[model samples]
Target chain A: MSCGSSPFGALADDTRRAVLSLLSEHGELTVTQIAEQFTHIGRTAVSMQLRVLRDAGLVKERRAGKYRYYSLRVEPVHEVISFLNSLYGASLDGLARAAEASADQEPAAASDAPDPTGTDKDTPRWGISY
Target chain B: MGNLVLSQQRHLALPPADVFALLGSDRTAGWLFGADYQALRVGALVQFELPLNPDDPNGSTVDAFGRIASLTPPHRLVIDQQSPWVGRLICTLTPVSGGRGTVVRLGVEVPEDAVTWLLRQRGYDPLEEPTPPATVRIGVLTSKSGPASVFAAATENLARMAAAEVNADGGVAGTGHKVHVVLRDDASKPEVGAVQFRRMVAVEGCRAVVTNVTSEVFDAVAPLARRLGALLIYTPVNEGGRFRPGVMRLGERPRGQLRLALPTLVREAGGKRCYLVGNDYVWPRTTNRVARAEIERIGGVVVGEQYRALGTTRFDDLIEDIAAAGADLIVSTFVGSDEARFERQSYAAGLRDTTRTLSLAFDESTREFTGDDAARGVWTTFNYFQELGSDGNTAFLRRYRATFGATAPPLSSITESVYEAIHMLAASGALNTDANLTELVSAVRAQRFSPTWPSAQPEQRRTGEKALYLAESIPGGFRISAN
Candidate 1:
């Protein structure tokens, strides 16, 4: 991972996400074990993805008896989760404000009032701002 | 031209023979899924079955036919593939200095699409290369959530497939530049779309945007595209009128779809009383307005008209009103989930016994979601359908199904339009530069796009005028009605 590269960037890849899920489920997995999970990609690709995860601090490596085992470290993802929470929160706020603004523009009594022009056109109603 | 060669080298903690053994015979099947040849030989035929989903081992698989060209155990192995995408795969194993581990050099003579797809499958950066190609970022905004989510299921997949094909065929008019597709979800809201649109252009440096969201999102993002100097192309059915500068519309217009299908539908149904139903939006409102006029021109009476909110599932009362009005012809402009629900509810109410429905936004996916029993006999018109019998359509569907397995979401006009739009943008070559909106639009209009890939005899059409086909819902899928 380089400067300004978020952990979410590491999670963007399908295989990486699968690997993380596998590690999270199994607690720890060797490179060969992780590679066995993916039939389309080779062990070389699996190793590269593990390296990326390690660099992003999304996974930690533990070497024992001439073999390396990788485990999940989900600290970096907490930031991303919080960011998503904030995004949803902000959108809800914006939606509430939009609804309030539309309510102010159109009075409640005017909603049911028939068109005086006797045309098929609908009266000015408060839109949902889609 | 010969296929491009992709090279990879990995140092493994194994001897030369051990490493060679790993990539050969039954061991090779561990990664390749299924290989017929156990002991590799020079003249032996090799077959591989690559799983569509790597996570699901017992799921569907795609066959890869190949023949071994050269084989030297512990040294080198080469194979030539014939089916799917033609390629020559080579693997070389070399012993380390101390015989501690072996160094493997793997190279595949394949198209960029295959190489990128392989890289992507492995969670590697597909665009990352030794000598990285110049990239033209294109933002694709679709409704991954909200009312239109049902219709947008395949938009992202089809758009990515088109971009991959473009890159494989030497990238955007042979400029040696790759199109990097950046996808964003608008949540079926214009406000969210506008935010995502700005982020794509400003933060992500996108030069062009292809949208599969609602028309409301277009109304919000069109002006922003002009101000930001980015090309915006909206792909899906919409009310056609005027084109905004820096924005291009490449979908079936309401006028064309209704004109071609309504007359035949009304005549066959043997009714002149029409009930207009749609969602309350610019598209549905505009479509209903046009539908009303078309109904009158054909000496038909407008029995009833109503616009419900988006995502309205309950059509119980609406069905009662239509039944009470004794509507013979039903013109439905409801979209996605709403469309599916309306079709189901109306069919359940036995409305189909007396009334015939002409759905403006019904596609293969919508038909499937609506269920075959409920959606049967419903009429729809669009520029493209997955059930089209044309040779070009067959090849297009074959390629699409090959890329995304047989069980993948069915193709729809709404989804197919995104593929066409992406191809058109790449064909223009304006994506490879910082051209202004006017120049981009002109360049795009000057080019024609093929709806099918790897087509020997392509059915090319301009975005302005595409051939429309009328289809009726049948068991399993749609039946394209003969004009």
Candidate 2:
């Protein structure tokens, strides 16, 4: 999903994230089965969390003979990954352009600047602070 | 210009053609509860039997006659119903994008002017002509002449008193508008209540409505109010588990009332073996479930339980059964005149001498009808009693007596609840003619005003929270015991 459409807001809770993890490990599980795995919470609470996840389009539900089976939808996760990739790719392109501009002006300022490798002693190359 | 409109939409997982076939073909009888209709075409007539009250199993059925006003194959169907109530129905079907499903929309509309004319012809005019701009109309729905009328004896009188009191005090807060009260008698029928509720909203332009009737009538009107975006303040003593948007119940719940009443009955009155009896309906059934649990919790044995239909007057056989069971206590949940008949017949059967009776439905007006001899020694528990000794109650009684004079209807919990409801509306800033549902509901939930008589304490859910009192019937009225 796009950043605005991501289910991360629903997964922010630890219990909901655990529910997602459980559904990912197991193919499909009913509300009773999912609730049985938790010791501190109750079936109603788990079902409510599942409802939130369902409303967020992070899970799909099916009915089979009085039982409801819930399974995770992977398309939203793929969309979230694509959104992250695009965001990081844009940042990397900006960094590459900055490096090229520095290289083009290196010869003109070679005598003035001692560091020919385009590395400033005070600044880290990875653009990260300690 | 006013029209009552009802619209409902649903999505089916079948194609549009399949859905249309189900709506148009004779096969619809199977799913529509055996409805009989002519072929789907313009000018065709359709007849069906719809339940008078869905909440009542034994309720009567009325015939619905409709003529096809327009027809478009598998796409749209418009039918006009011209019996009991005047209304037009339209159904539309559209295919979904996937071509495997369909969206269906059903709508019903009734012209308010025709309904108002019909009501006036029946000697009931719940709407007024050309409401003044500076007046806030509040609709009052109650049973004025029916089987349940005994319970709502003072509802209209008390509501009028409250309105007058509010208008005397400079009208509603923030808005200097006088209150105009519109009264409608549901006649203890859910169908009637539903139609009246629509008329009040669509024609009278009521900002809010106060309903004091049976749970069945409330059930029928609540959904319509929600659909019409009308604010409904339900005041009654029934099963009391209903919660919805724009609907607030400010009455005693079965669990809360029984929790206090049953345990006290078992301990103080020595009620070891208990029997249950009530009208056969959803409210009685659900309430008895809670009463049964509470009786069991208090170390009492339930000897027998029985239910009779509403308006059932003869109780000789039921009284004989209660006597045969030799139960020490009878927890009667009957409402209105049915309750009076049971009490009087039980007294005549001499069951009153050996067995004590605790009624959840017993109030001052019902007690008056039950007679002094029959009601004597009978016990009841409720949130409000007219004899309550409080500064607020004394002043309220004095003002009520002064306004209505000596021959007024006796004040009871049901009536006082309606009285309290009007004040609650004013206190919550819901008396404004322009208030919306969200604003009114939120104001009611956040309200904590104390009326002259305290029932339940103010809470967010609109359920009353007050100290319950147990009283014994005296010659003409109840002698409330110290709590």
The number of the candidate with the highest TM-score is 1
- Candidate 1 per-residue lDDT over residues B114-198, each given as its tens digit: 3333332223322222234588878889875456766554786788898899898888864658888887666577866886687
Q: Which number leads on DockQ? A: 1
**lDDT values, one for every candidate:** 0.68, 0.67
For residues B1-483, write the lDDT of model 2, one tens digit per residue: 366454545444444565555543432222121244455656554544433332322344433445567888678877765433445667677666455444555565656643443333222233266667888888999875445776543676688888898788877766868887887767677877887788788767887899888888888988988788888888778676657898888777888877767766766556689999998887888888888898888788899999998778799999999999989888988988789889989999899777888888799877876767889868888778888777667778887778754434567778788887787777676667778888888876676333332332223223334667788899868998735
Runs in model 2 lying further than 4 Å from the true structure: A1-130, B1-126, B449-465
| Cand 2, B chain, TM | 0.72
Lowest summed lDDT window (length 10), candidate 2 chain B: B26-35
Per-model DockQ against the true two-chain complex: 0.02, 0.01
Q: Between which residue pairs do clashes occur in model 1?
A: none
TM-score of each: 0.59, 0.58
Worst 10 residues of 1 chain B by lDDT: B120-129
CAPRI docking class of candidate 1 = incorrect
Error (Å) of candidate 2 at residue B382 is 0.9
lDDT measured at residue B144 in model 1 versus the true structure, 0 to 100: 55
